[model samples]
Target: MVEVRPLPSADSPLVEAVDLAKHFDVSPPWLTRVLERQPRTLLKAVDGVSFAVPRGRTFSLVGESGCGKSTVARLAVGLYTPTAGRLVFDGTDLAGLNSRAAMAPVRRRLQMIFQDPFASLNPRWRVRDIVAEPIRAHGLLSETRAIDRRVGELLELVRLTAADGQKYPHEFSGGQRQRISIARALASNPEFLVCDEPTSALDVSVQAQILNLMKDLQRELGLTYLFISHDLAVVYHISDYVGVMYLGRLVEWGEARSLFRKPQHPYTRMLLDAIPDLEMTGRRRIPVRGEVPSPMNPPSGCHFYPRCPFANERCRAEVPLSITLPHGGEVRCHAVEEGRLTEAAVRQALGRGASAP
Candidate 1:
């Protein structure tokens, strides 16, 4: 049997997502639906997902595209209201804050660094204006000189010269544009940052630089982060805790080292197996087979069962509950719960009939 550990108390987490869910109405218009005799269709973007990020830590959600990682980011930042569940930031219930005015204080403490730096920055505006916009909006300083000085400091913090602020975003490289985005996110002096694939668009070397910068900033400012990404390598490099999602639900989550060292869920193991070997030797690669099921008409029970080699009748009939592991991680998999699968078994399966990458 898998060992289990107690989770942190509810009041302890700086940001907590409790059974969060978001469903989009993708059905045709009323007239079209009636004419076709079609029922309403709902896209399960995020379904019953929950996690907690302690202060001054990075909690990263990683999975393939369309796994609802981005939707969870939007939900945490209040861009999308939950169709079910709630988000509590520093003990404040976000759903209770109905209006913009009411959410202002919370907004000031939380900000987002969007995925596309090129599109996120205004092409028409100078970097100074872009960085200072948040400062001005938050009413941090009314004096023009003070705002300008703050903008310059932010640029310098991101390792860009103050003079670069005079130029437009189009003039800068991808890495620099992302740095400017980071500076803008910092302008409001936010305590928590929601970074949605912030470095995915940059070159490998540039990605390293940005990751280092983020780490330094987190250390200096004592910031908390909800980092969303599809790259396991990046997640391993930066995250304190990691959550693996599939079809809008988290299949496994735990400390980064623990999860990577011994992933409990079949989906998590499959994702790790997809990573290429560095030496390009004839290493046996465990194939993660099958295409993802459509969220609109997702299979009943476990979402990952179709792709999982060890899946049985129970996996196809009953959804597994989150099981806490000895290392304080959580996994949602029947194979693990029933003791049919373990870390040793995973290693053995990967070795048996593993194909070369």
Candidate 2:
């Protein structure tokens, strides 16, 4: 079982992303490049994104698919190296931890729960082996009996019976498999977890179970999470703070309640409008307009210019820098910056297609 420890005070950042960026070369083959006289092409998967997760709090990134949310998750866990910028974890720069021996202790405190539970666990491995692998790899215990005991404790902690450890991955349901994945993550007693859409693959009811389980674990163990997902409802339910991304850039970010209550950016407002209200309220649903442009040939100015309802010549000509909002979040949009996109104005505009609330 994962041991609980005193959490650091909330005054400092537990994980910091400073101008983080990741670029992948997607150029043509050398011979094709020469024949076509083509230069190198780079896909800016993540570009100049920055955020911080306070100790013991959940910080989430929500965006459309291919907006680099998964890339950010992988970068946070050191699975992918940044092409630029720095990722500072608990005051230590991950870039400086060059060797396995140097990163061993850090690795023990940082774990990742991948997106698909079916693919994350080894089908061939028994539950016991899967849960015990981290503990064994970290050399946390010596004897086989001791490791077995720990594995049993972890399984029980996640609400699984010790006897269940005898079963293989295929024997469990989707939720059960996710619980096993969580147990494995906690095996080394990690301080922070990078959950890459951990509950996305399950049924809605099962997703709630997993989410509740994660929240309970966080409260009980003082665990910090950097959650990544495209589901706005899930993000709303789980995140303390949220960052909205568009084409590799953070378009808006702030406290979850604030962003949801009064989204400042056009892209953010559009996303919130897409959330379905089950009460059959008169609130309008503004369908997300246009598809995300290719990263390799993204717009020169604001990435969302092509789809933004408020886009103008200025928006298409110059990129908007991150500007602080009156209430506490940051937004990157020319309309919001110049007071051109007020709450009332946007409501009136989108209300044309929406029913009266």
Candidate 3:
């Protein structure tokens, strides 16, 4: 029998990832490599990432397109096994669970919302079946009548009526299809959700609607979330804590308000600078320099040193360990660690006056 563990206290994180890493072998075939005298290539999609999602709260990972946020999402839900490190759900180490049967109990409480709603749902499956799949697969409801009733409840919970479930996925609009996806995810009564750019594919107006609905659901169900997105605006709205990723590693992470108000890492500041200055603070925004380096051949020391303005020889030669910040959270930057990147220096670099606050 699968051992069931008690849920952790509210004060403890519901999901924790410690030094999580996922590497993909993207090299040429063995035969081809032998003939061409080429070395094998490994893509470090997520390298040594760590974070925790508090129960009933959202922890968001934000970064550029290839920064491995989605890979982290998949790792959280067990879609891809981690190449190293541990993924702990509640109190159980997911990697320690050896078999599919052993993983079932834990899997039932975790679900994922994909980027594209149109592609996630089956074309021929009715919305009812799609939403009911998790319930049946988990054997949560055996009787037809009970399952149907539960499906109706799930649909209504996502703000869609039972009647809508009778139709196919193609019959609904993009937003409605995503709603169906949410309903399906919720059908298993999951305690945690890994949402991977769930709103990116929708129109801006519709994105707000979906985000609002997710927030409402969280409040109502006390669900935990590991949200992945490239949009800082969206992360700002939904996240209680935020981690900024670069080259598969978390560069900076802390409470959302603190991190956004006073970003310490150069990459984090660069990202915030890219946001339009709607309040017209007149702070000179630094245009991000250089392209992101390929993950297969990341720089030797700090992965971000190539584009970091404050990088010195030390930064280029040695990896910076994570340093605890005064307010809260941690940053992995040699400049920040060595006291070279002070608040005044950051403000000056951004062309902001001392009084600008």
Candidate 4:
């Protein structure tokens, strides 16, 4: 069994990811590359990304698809080793796990709620087996009766009927299947959950149901979450803090309210502007220009420079260092770092005064 130490203090970051990176060798085989007289190519899925999520808090990574949010999620839960940097979970170094077998213990403490409930659940398995797999793997219960009781409790915890466990996964709806997945993740009594776009596939009403269930579970279980989503509206509703990743780097990260109120990174502002507000009375929205560049050969200097309206010669020639905010978190943008954007300039671009920049 995993021995989880009492969280050091309420103020400490529950998960601290620093300069985490993953570079995939997407090139042809070594012999093929050699025969073609071409060097192997590297795809930078996550390059120097960093952020922190506190206990019982939700920190979401939001961006366009293929912006490495899922890659970061995989790295956090010990599914993939980072090419560089660290992922410290509740003060323990996650990079030190020697093998996949050794990672079993950590797996119980940190569970992943994967995307596509239909694809994630085994169609051949009964709901009881699906939810009980984690408990049985960890040897949390020795007796069959005890395991069955635990499975029933988990199903009820996620608002499913205990009797539902007797049915096959094919017998359930997409939302019900997702509830089963949640029960499976919670069977190990995990403190952290890395949710990878869990509701993107569901209907609008079902999305709200799943998100509410997650929130209720978090409050009851004191769970820390790393929610990855391209849905800015959903991210804003569920996240306490938000990180915007571009190409492979974290361009901005801070309190969700603060970042949304005052987006320091141009890329972040662009994303927010794209979300149409039904209730935002007089807010002017800025349209995003150009497509996200290919990661195999991203633009140099600054990844956002190509499309940033505020980009200057310096922004085009050198990458901007992070600009520390007085409240918390930081932004990686040349205009924010150099104090170049006037209040009027920002108002002109975003059509509003920020509450944080």
Q: What is the C-alpha RMSD of each candidate to the true structure, in Å?
A: 5.7, 1.7, 2.6, 2.8
TM-score of each: 0.94, 0.96, 0.95, 0.94
Candidate 4 clash pair list: none
Q: Write the per-residue lDDT of candidate 1 for residues 176-225, one digit (tens) a residue.
A: 99999999999988888999999999999999999999999988777789
Give the deviation of candidate 2 from the true structure as CA RMSD. 1.7
lDDT of each prediction vs. the true structure? 0.90, 0.91, 0.92, 0.89
The C-alpha stretches of model 4 lying farther than 4 A from their native spots are 1-9, 280-284, 348-357
Model 4 Cα lDDT, one tens digit per residue, 155-185: 9999999999999998988898899999999
The weakest ten consecutive residues by lDDT in model 2 span: 348-357
lDDT of 2 by residue, 1-357 (tens): 446576667778899999999999999999999999999999999999988899999999999988999999998988888999999998888877888898898889999998899999999999999999999999999899999999999999899999999999999999999999999999999999999999989999999999999999999888999999989999999999999999999999999999999998999988988889878876667898889888789997899998888889999999899999888889999998889986567767675633454
**What would the TM-score be for candidate 1 when compared with the true structure?**
0.94
Range of the 10 consecutive residues with the lowest summed lDDT in candidate 3:
1-10
| Ten contiguous residues minimizing lDDT sum, candidate 4 | 1-10
Clashes of 3: 0
